[model samples]
Target: MFRGTGFGTYYYDVRQVEACDTSFVAQNLSPLECSSQNALSLNHVNSNYVVAMNHSQLKLDMSKYCGKRVIVTVNGEQSNLPLFIGDGCQRCAGGSASSDVWNAVAAPGLDFSYSVLEELSGGAACADGHIQIAWEIVDDTIYNFSDGVNFETAPAEASEERTTSSAALVMSTSLSAASFLHTPVNDDPVQNAVAVLARQGYGDATEASSNNALPTDGLLASLAEPR
Candidate 1:
């Protein structure tokens, strides 16, 4: 417990294995400030996280966890906010290593108390939430492999309409072959071939045959190969 010279002002702290809790008292103190006279400014608590309150609003600091993902709850309400390190809250002195919690109280305006909980173990562990730093750090692998092909060939027939004549074909068949050797090869030709074939012999039939005989396979085969 810390006492101030004024009538009713003091600071108290409770310690836990994973957390530190602090409380403050303010009596006959107007515009009470923890970090400074301005309530907008964040206090420099020893810990990575800090919470301060003024007559009008509450201020918090969790910036120490920047680059290190974390989540916080205030008065039992989870923030559910992006706990992006360095971005949210204010950076305190000595980082999160200093004090897990710190508090100060001021009054003569109103009486209130605040409770905060910070869980470092549950949030994303890295700057980019995409990768789990724990898994990556533990593995310490020097190399990674992906199943795909890489093209290393010069354009032999760079045709825009035909894939077989494009650089991708040369890479897939030759340079990229080494990577996809185990994968089954694609047997079907490119779409350009099908389009070219569709144009052949189209609209060539006489009106009588076109109207009477359907263009079904049977009719087409009968016309081409007479029985």
Candidate 2:
């Protein structure tokens, strides 16, 4: 156990082993980022794949084709991702795509070509979230790829924001009025320091008799930005 700041012992790991069917096995897991094995190809620019959690990993060894270019895709949507290598690899050939599992935390699918030495990296996403990358090899250049796609954990509410001209006018009038108050304070330091707030949106500022209190002049005009 690692002794430190009130935290208990922490450990992490991943498994990648190659089997006879041209696939790698991945057992035990730690949060690790993934990258493509095929480093140089054209198709890799716009394709994706999937890798299962704790199953096997995709292969990277491409000794079979040392001087050719190939394209690959990687797609995934799983958490608790792993990095595969050698025997634990899900695909030893480094060329294939995978389908996703229903209701799975995160699954990765990759399309890459094996043309040379493969660098198996981990924790590509940094957090426990899953991120997928693809590899391609053409001619001699090695290409790594993935598109910037984000899937929200929760589905978006299909709602619209609506406000009429009268509503806006009323709000404006209310702000510079004799009596005005805002909702809860925001995180901005400037708002926190404002001890008093008052606006004179309505009422005239003309000098009526000295007996009557002229509507207070607006010191706090348009205090908050309209959402």
Candidate 3:
């Protein structure tokens, strides 16, 4: 079980991860390279509360939650949501959720997925493009990934009222992931430069050079030139 108060945002229409695409960023590259690999699709998943968290923050063995259900609580409202890992180092406090979960707590605004801002503000505007939320993964189970791929739908009446009480190992931590428009930029120039290189499919900068030196001025100058 993972629990903490952090930030939350809603996302939709992100059915697949793409090469070098900012949306649905993942720490692992294997998922992005394989066409069949994907985050839980809203249409395919049985529940409406699927979410993706920052891999770095969660730091759990992927095998534990890859295809399992976790009980997620927000604002005293609880739901069993499918969990996945999103971008690692870019996000710190907030992770992304499906739009259905967002609609339950706040008003609808933009048709496209970004970050939850005014939609979650309850008519009040928020400058951060995010809403502070208390959320927790109260329970999780070991599940077969193959079986989970073909999800089952629960009865409509049970959707909102569903609850889980299974005993699970309790682990506490905050979750986070970046949104397309509102990803917080790092202040350190070297970190920023490394991030730019990583975004361009240059492989993980943290593991790139044997000596781990800051990117040279020549390399930074080259990045400024038009591709």
Candidate of highest TM-score: 3
Candidate 1 residue lDDT tens string, 1-227: 11111111112112222212332323112222332332221121212222221222222422222123223333334444322121111221112222223222222111111222223224322221111111001111111112111111123224444765576678767855544433333433322223233444334333336455535535445545634
- For model 3, residues 1-227, the per-residue Cα lDDT tens digits are 55555555544324433322344333222231111345434434432234445444444454443434444344566533344322222244233433323332332211112322233444333243445555544334433344444233434335544432121211111112233223435775556776766665666766745575445546765765666
lDDT values for all models: 0.26, 0.27, 0.40
Error of 2 at 141 (Å): 28
TM-score of each: 0.19, 0.19, 0.35
On the 0 to 100 scale, the lDDT of residue 4 in model 3 is: 52
Q: Which residue runs does candidate 3 get wrong by more than 4 Å?
A: 14-48, 57-59, 68-90, 93-128, 141-144, 149-227
After superposing all C-alphas onto the true structure, candidate 1 shows an RMSD in angstroms of 20.3
CA displacement after TM-score superposition, residue 143 of candidate 3 (Å): 8.1
Q: Which candidate order results from sorting by lDDT in descending order?
A: 3, 2, 1
Over 1-227, each residue of candidate 2 has an lDDT whose tens digit, in order, gives 00001100011111222322222222222222233342322222221122211123222332322222333323422222212211112322222245322112233333221111122123232232222444432343222223322122112322212345567788889775523344425675334324222122333333335564333323223334353
Model 2 bad stretches (over 4 Å) = 1-145, 152-199, 210-227
